[model samples]
Target chain A: MSSAALVELRDVVVGYGELPILTGVDLRIDTGEIVSVIGGSGSGKSTLLRAMVGLLEPAAGAVCLFGQDLYATRPRSRGRLLSRVGVLFQSDALFSSMSVLDNVMFPGRKLTDLPDAVIQELALIELARLGVADLAERMPQEISGGQAKRVALARANVLAPELVFCDEPTSSLDPINAAVLGREFTRLRDDQGSTVILVTHDMEMVRTLSDRTVVLAAGGICAVGTPATLERSEDLDVQALFHGEPTRESQESKRA
Target chain B: MDVRLDAIRPRSLLHELEIHARTRPAVLRLDLSALRQIDSTGVATLRAVTRRLRRSGVAVELHGATPEVMRVLAETPEPDPPKHPPEPGVLESLGRSCFAWWSGLLTLADMVIEAMQGAAGAVVGRRTFAWRDVVEQLELMGADALPIAATMSFLLGLVLDFQTWVQMHYYGTESVVLEFVGIGMARGFAPFIVAILLASRTAPAIAAQLSTMEMRQENDVLRVMGISPVRHLVVPRLFAITLVTPALSLIATASGILGGLLVTVWLDPHWMAAFETMLREMTLGDLWLGTVKSVLFGWVIGLASAFTGLHSGYGALSIGIAATRAAVASILFVMIVDSIVTTLWTMAQ
Candidate 1:
């Protein structure tokens, strides 16, 4: 891949209230790379994603997308920049009243000047790609959890954004569906040349999809390398994450 | 060579740059003195063009950029603004509130139009209306409310008759008691009381139902599906209320007249003469005016309840708050409509 950084986080410090989640963190992601951010609960994996997506402002430092500081831009300009980015929320966050097809079509209808027929055709194509075109007319509530996730993925990727952020995409899926989603992510990168940042706990997913893995611990990046390298990481926290071992701090806290 | 740039809109600037780069000058200097504003897109376009040109072994330099353009290009991060905006001054707040109320009213009016169109479509057999939903709401807002409405109207009539009888007895005008009760129950008490009862009872129920839908994001689903929630969820309830409320009011009027008759008969053995006098004094105009007012009251209550419910915030607590607001707003609207209708009818008389 070319040495072009699609996303750059320079000493980004993000927190809620006074409690810091991410402190002085630096990272760069190149175009067409699938990066996985893996950590235990409350390690601020989601917080980092939110900060990168402009949903939450960092307490300090900068998150630059395509060489422009995201939060430094005017609100309107920020919104326009955000159109080139797609996010798959943990909850799926599908509009419950709309049918699956309509949910997939929603972003395109809002952001593009495409005609209704063309938009519909595109939405159907996405649904067919995800193998859920038969469930297109089904309401979000009517679909199974896995189906909902797939539908949400289709919706997020429908805009064909340059970057896609997937938050726990495989957390609630069955093994078969999880495998399907992993393949889909790989397909997204290969076909669309889109960079993906996946936040997940499923180590199997990390092994299957991520070109690189970032291990977050103690409000900072503990290690970042390929999944194979991370599997062999010497850092105790990184080892604890990969091997499911309790680090000294966590064990001490448990005793306390 | 200097190339001047003007009106560098972010949306189109990238495309414009590609067209400019087609000439492939060995040395390109962009003069931005004419640029009044530069957005994030404009900045991004410049960066992309610079990178692309650098790869192609062409020299590029930006010159004559104004301070504003320079600031954006520098990507100097500003301190984040306060999370919550500063509170507006009192007058400004008032103006904002008035504008919000006016905007809300316009939205409600628009929803009402959409609902009416949907209802009309149902009537003309062009669209399918949820007959089952309308029936369910009718049972809830109309049939279930009958007992309380009847009891309240009966007590109201008894009190009116007793109070009027005592005063008339002092003047030896006790014979007018039946006429006074009949005219008062038909013209004012029955429709007004029934409307207030429904506003308190049915409005909250509808509001809670819709607010729960909102909380669950069901309303959002409808919006995403390109279906109007007002037309789908609200029109049925509005129609049911509009059709059933007048019937309930008529029942209230009958129960009230019966209660007054019972009181008059108990007070005097020769109550038949008073009954005949009341019949002679009662007019169709009075009955029709009360019916019209009841209909208007029903429409106002339904509209108010649905409006508050559909706009409710997320969660169970928000649903409860929305229900309370809907009830209070519905009652207030009913009273206002009642007052205006009564005044207009009185003036016509």
Candidate 2:
């Protein structure tokens, strides 16, 4: 991997209203690294991803992508830069009114100057690649949850973005599909040289596909290291996260 | 060695930095002493340029910065100019309202064309048009609306006859009440009353349904698939409302005339023969005008309702707000269109 950082978050504090969900988070991700950010519910895993993707602006600090501050740039320039980044929402966020084939073709049609035939062919190839070519004709409503996830994956990678943010991509999938998605993530990093930031609770995904694991606790990164290294973390919060135990703070809150 | 950094503002700071970075000086010294104010964009530009220059093996140094500029540079970019939403002046608000109204009219025209195309497509064996959905909407907007519309029309006719009958009877022109009731009920009252009722009834229902779909992200799904929700959803409902409302208006006209006939029988026991003769004198042109008005009113209700629903903001509260807005807008549009049509028709006669 190159020494240049693809993404850097410097003391980012994100929130809605007054209560900050992520506070003073500083992290740097190198190009072509698959980093899994794991946290319990409301630990701001998705918030971190949203901030990095420019969907949410941080209350303080900065998010720099390719040395350009993502939120600081003008909207038009930021939009242009965002074309190089892909985001897979937790809900899949598939356009409900369109066929799966058209859903996959959406980003390509928006971002590229390709002919309709070429766009369609590329979309078909992506669907085929994800083993969902046969379901392309079906509407998003017609497809199963797992099929929708695959279609969403196809759409995200259709542009062959340099960076991809996947939010709980494997959360609703079956074990088989989850495993396939894990492999797809590896393939994306290996073949396309895409830097991936996956926000998920699925530790098996982290163990299999991630080059590094970031554990978020109390609105900040509690630990960041290899999955195996994080498993042996001395911090109680970090240990509790990996072990799936309720942290002392959570227990106290629960009792109160 | 000295690199002069120019005025740093949010607008063009990033572009300026990119231009500066391309020169690739061996030793870059940024003179920021002249910088009066710097936003977050400016700070980000400086950091990015510094990083880019460092990568190219150029030495970067900041020579002089005003304390204010230095402080801005130290902190995360000035919290992006506290995004004060512009409070539009009266003229600005009027201009915006005019633009919105014009845009709405254009959208309604487009929706009508799309609906016609869908109807034509269905007729020509293209299943892309949703005939089943149209039928469903027809049942909801037309069949389900029959009872309340009929009752309202009947009550309107009875009230009109009762109010005017005593005056006509005193003038010994009781027979003129038949022509008054017939023309008024057929050309004016029935269609107008039915339209207002539907505006309150069907328009809100359509808006609520569509707003729910929007909140649920179903509309977003359609957008992502490159499918126009207006074409898919609005077209069917528009067609159904347009085709069914005239039929309902015809029913209302009959019910209203019957209400007048019943009132005449009650007021004067021997006036049934005179009422029938006067009713038979009613013109076909009057009935046609009512039908035309009802159809136009239906179009207004459907277009306004669907437009408000499709553009609704997120949340359950927004759905109710959208429905209310749709009803209000539809009624307003119907009144405007009705006045214009009535004026034109009267002028031509």
Candidate 3:
């Protein structure tokens, strides 16, 4: 265990109401690492991401960010810690009323001292990088799912924040665009030295790009290794999941 | 391009910085000796401007600052706006405004046409009408709202009767209060009460439901299934409100008149005389006119809220915002339509 973990969740128990989803979940994500969390459908992957990001509180144990207990700290301190992080939700949760330009420019406006001109320039550059600059004036509802995802990415990265959590960032994008986004995430880690956490089942992304791959099953992390190591594991469940082979969960879901 | 002879100590430094950017100054130096007082905002703005200039391929150096100013400058950077957001060009802004207005008008027009068609189809027994949903909405918005409407109208009648009786008492002609309350209740008060109450309550309910559905993409799912949301979802609410508003108005009139009667009998032993006077003056025409106005009010509220919900942006916050807009727009339009209808009917009468 490195003493310099950016985010560490120890024996975390998380759930919705009474239905426990992820129990005793322990994980450590280090600085400047692009860590991908992979799971079967309904394996509490998003819940883990949500808990780690402080959007959902753990039912038990400690979740720390940047060495401070995120939920236990005073609100001001928590906010100060959170301001360094960016998130791209699975829903592409853009403000519906704002134009794409304003949506992308929002974080810089709210979180930084950068002048409007500078922020706009940054936001435009980000949008152009993601190939959504032409859609800047359109509302979120007017854009396609893939375009919205790109716009969300631009918004998330506009400030070049120190930490980022992306949920299904390229699910809707085509192969080329997903590849572009994968490279962008790499640049985020390499250029800005930002920690990138991706909650995805995009195997190509996991295999080719991520520094580490964490597989979630039952209620907690089942395996944590390099993608290749996980793929070659003796664990039958890991192999079944990697090859999309039917397991008990899949069989149950099919019946359901 | 090494333009480094700047000793400007002017307060309007940002303007000077922008001017320097255009000239492509390689190095810029600021003499801050005249800067006596500097707040955190000023410090952040200075940094932001310098950072911007540096990003644009310029080097900015600050010199001649007192320790106090230097302390402020070294403080942690916070958010501060040095300039308003760059505006869209005039033509682009104008184009957006025009398009927005046109879209709003189009949404309203779309709602009105669909509402009318739904109502007509339901009346004509067309299979396209969502009669089942209409019944459910009526139960939800109409029956559930009866007690509040009736109680509110009862209070209005009590207040009106008491105030009028006090004023009329001075002239020894307080009996006119009975007839006045009766005519007022039948002609305007009941309809106004029912319409306003529903506008405040049911309009927002409709807006929230529809907006949430839209946000969750449930409306889109309906569209994908080859069902029009307007026909299947909105028409039911429209029919229910249109019918329910008039019925509630009529019920409210009775409740109000009953309240006035209670006040009349309490104040005077010859309550029969007052009751007869009220009955004589309460014409059916006044009742019908009030009901007609209520129908229109129902349409205004239903359509405004429906239009707002359909056009609402995605997300829970936008759903809440849409509901608020629905409540305000429905109430405002209801009042405006009330005044116009009242004036036109008075002229005809």
Candidate 4:
């Protein structure tokens, strides 16, 4: 990863059919940075992720990947660009018919001309890194919800994409599992030098994993700062989401 | 404290057995009347309790269980479910493609034979399948299809009526316009033409949409959510098409009749009398036969369109091709089936 910015969305406006979801949103991801995007549900968080990967084209703005205009490229070439951007969808979008191993290998097979044995070997290696190697043979139905999330993470990392985008990755996971994912996400940035864009409501995850955080509310950026800066900032909406959600101390005291 | 009869047998054998141990300290006198109905499930429940208690080095004694319950425990055993987890062998996975799959090869050998055998099962089974998805698709395909098909068919009738009168007027046979309209628009041409129109306009559209959704793994999403794609996706379209095709065909028939009436009534005042006379001259079988053809046409249109949609490949371009091929295939199938039925019905007379 060079010092250059990996992805840049300049004055981006995106829409679905006639309805505009994102309006003139400007954002950038530099190489090897962990940036967490926090927003309320349906606030164009997922839409921004889609636009970054060129899945949803920005209607009136430009999305440039590694300094190349996404729209100028042919659709096939754009897919090549997208292949380098790994996405972990909000729903853990795993293929139900394929086993854990097969799902991981799907992207690798698409992005590389490696032999079957090589692909399988690489897939298993990634699964092991995600701590889901034992679940390679298990069907998606057989795995627990947390286990399925890990498998999806393994699949997203299969191609070793330079930019990884996660949508509410820790939402449904238990504390232990969520912590494990947060640690791994930090390691991805520190070890592989990969830039990560995490869209989540989990405030603790934002504090622990992200170096920089952007708060989105009512469909626009509310604030931008480090975790400490955010905690001390006099932003009511940000403070409400961060501390307003029942903290562990409150929950345990309530139990008592 | 006494154990209730209802507590002896529970919906979940495991939960019931575990809950029983919880109440053991409180319930000194337990009613075990429900234990008599304890078959394998009940014995297993007891065995689970015994195993847990034994592991904890606790000795448990039960007095209320009858001799019949003791006998059932001695005889009843739990058998593990068969180890048939769907591990589609490496060979089977490799055989998943059309060029490589055994079923695909067989499908190629006798297309008609396979279709006939598969049709009844697929149609009936898919009637309840993907029903929600099919309903969603009907809104997309059938409801939308009506406007385009009706517009084309209506214009087609008008064109045919105008063109026919121009040629027949050269022979001074303007009064015979109803004779041409009744036979031309009712007997074979009306149903066949309407079927062809729907096949072209709607069938391919269904195929393309399904193929695109398939590419997006929308079908997989439904499957993961434990939704039956056929029940949720196919049935509604099948039902909708079954419903809409006839209404559309009737519209086409009405348009053709009205077009013919306009041409003849304007050209000559004797057109109504000629049409009534022609109605008497033509056999009632012609009218009945046309209605029968319409039903067959509806079935063919609905079935072929849905089948093509369901089997479409996982690419945007492939969806377009599937839609086109579906239309072509449906048109051909409808014509062939209609031709065969016509020949058979006419020969039986």
lDDT of each: 0.84, 0.83, 0.83, 0.70
Model 3 interface CAPRI class: incorrect
- Taking all chains together, each candidate's TM-score versus the true structure is 0.53, 0.53, 0.49, 0.46
> Candidate 4: misplaced stretches above 4 Å?
A1-4, A245-256, B1-349
Compared with the true structure, what per-residue lDDT tens digits does model 4 show for residues B62-165?
A: 55777898788667766653688687787777766544556644543443343444445556663323344446655765576666665665566567767777
lDDT string for model 3 (A5-89, tens) is 7999989999887788998888888898999999888999888887776667888988898998888986557667777777787
lDDT of 3: 0.83
lDDT of 1 by residue, B55-153 (tens): 777788999888888988787454433589688999999998998899988988888888788788777864335577799889999999999999999
Candidate number that wins on DockQ, 1 or 4? 1
lDDT of 1 by residue, A1-256 (tens): 5554789999999998778998999999989999999998999999998788876789899998887898898655776777788778777778765689988987777567788789889999988888899999999889899998899989888888899988899987899888888988998899999999999999988987899999999989989999999886667787777778857786565457
Query: For model 2, how does the per-residue alpha-carbon lDDT over B166-219 read when each residue is reduced to its tens digit?
Result: 888998877768668878888978999889989999999989888888886556
Highest-lDDT candidate: 1
Q: After aligning candidate 3 to the native by TM-score, how far in Å is the CA of B121 from where it should be?
A: 3.3
| Candidate 2 local lDDT, residue A11 | 93
Q: Provide all candidates' interface root-mean-square deviations.
A: 7.8, 6.4, 15.2, 10.2
**Backbone clash numbers for all candidates listed:** 3, 6, 0, 15
Poorest 10 consecutive residues by lDDT, candidate 4 chain A: A245-254
Q: How far does residue B89 in candidate 4 sit from its true spot (Å)? A: 58
